[model samples]
Target: MALMITDECINCDVCEPECPNHAISMGEEYYQIEPSKCTECVGHFDEPQCAMLCPVACIPVNPAHVETRETLMQKYVRLTQTAA
Candidate 1:
């Protein structure tokens, strides 16, 4: 599943740069995760970098964008291919 930044976020800015897929961004009030670009580090790291590094533990799985590991890997491949 993709991850989401909750309102509990302190906006400490630690999560943004750590996301390998560049899915996190500053929203109107806090950070937001773009579901389409979020693969939870499936192809890049064993854990989601943003979630793992968030000091406040505000990042959580996006229930609305639930997906399997294989699906996430497919998304990762597509993203990388597009970037290339």
Candidate 2:
């Protein structure tokens, strides 16, 4: 599943850069993870970068957009599908 930012977020700007997929962005008053872009680090890292660097620990799994490894992989494939 993708990650999400809750209202508990302090808007500390700690999670933005940690996202390898560039899925996290500064929302109106919190950080938001784009479901279409997030893979929970499936194709990038062993763990979710936002959670690792988040100071407030406001980032959590996006249950509304739950997806399996194969689905996440497919998302990753489309995200970086451009020819080299």
Candidate 3:
């Protein structure tokens, strides 16, 4: 599942840079994670960078965009391939 930034986010600006997939961005009121680009760090790290780095623990799995580990890996591969 893609991780989501909740309203509890302090806008500390740390999570955005930590996201390996460039999925996190500054939204109108806080940080937002793009579901399409979020891979839960399956291809780049052992865990989600943004969630691990978020000081307030505002990042959580987006239940609305639920996906399996294999699916996330597939998305990561597609993203990397497109970037290459």
Worst-scoring 10-residue span by lDDT in model 3: 15-24
Q: For model 3, state the Cα shift of residue 60 in Å.
A: 0.6
How well does each candidate superpose onto the true structure, as a TM-score?
0.98, 0.90, 0.97
The clash tally of candidate 3 reads 0
- Candidate 1 stretches with Cα past 4 Å from truth are none
Top TM-score hit: 1
lDDT of each: 0.95, 0.86, 0.93
Worst 10 residues of 1 by lDDT: 51-60
lDDT score at residue 65, model 1, on the 0-100 scale = 99
Compared with the true structure, what per-residue lDDT tens digits does model 2 show for residues 8-49? 998888788878788988888877899989989988988898
Higher-scoring candidate on TM-score, 1 or 2: 1
Q: What is residue 65's positional error in candidate 3, in angstroms?
A: 0.6
- Candidates, ranked, TM-score: 1, 3, 2
Clash list (residue pairs), candidate 3: none
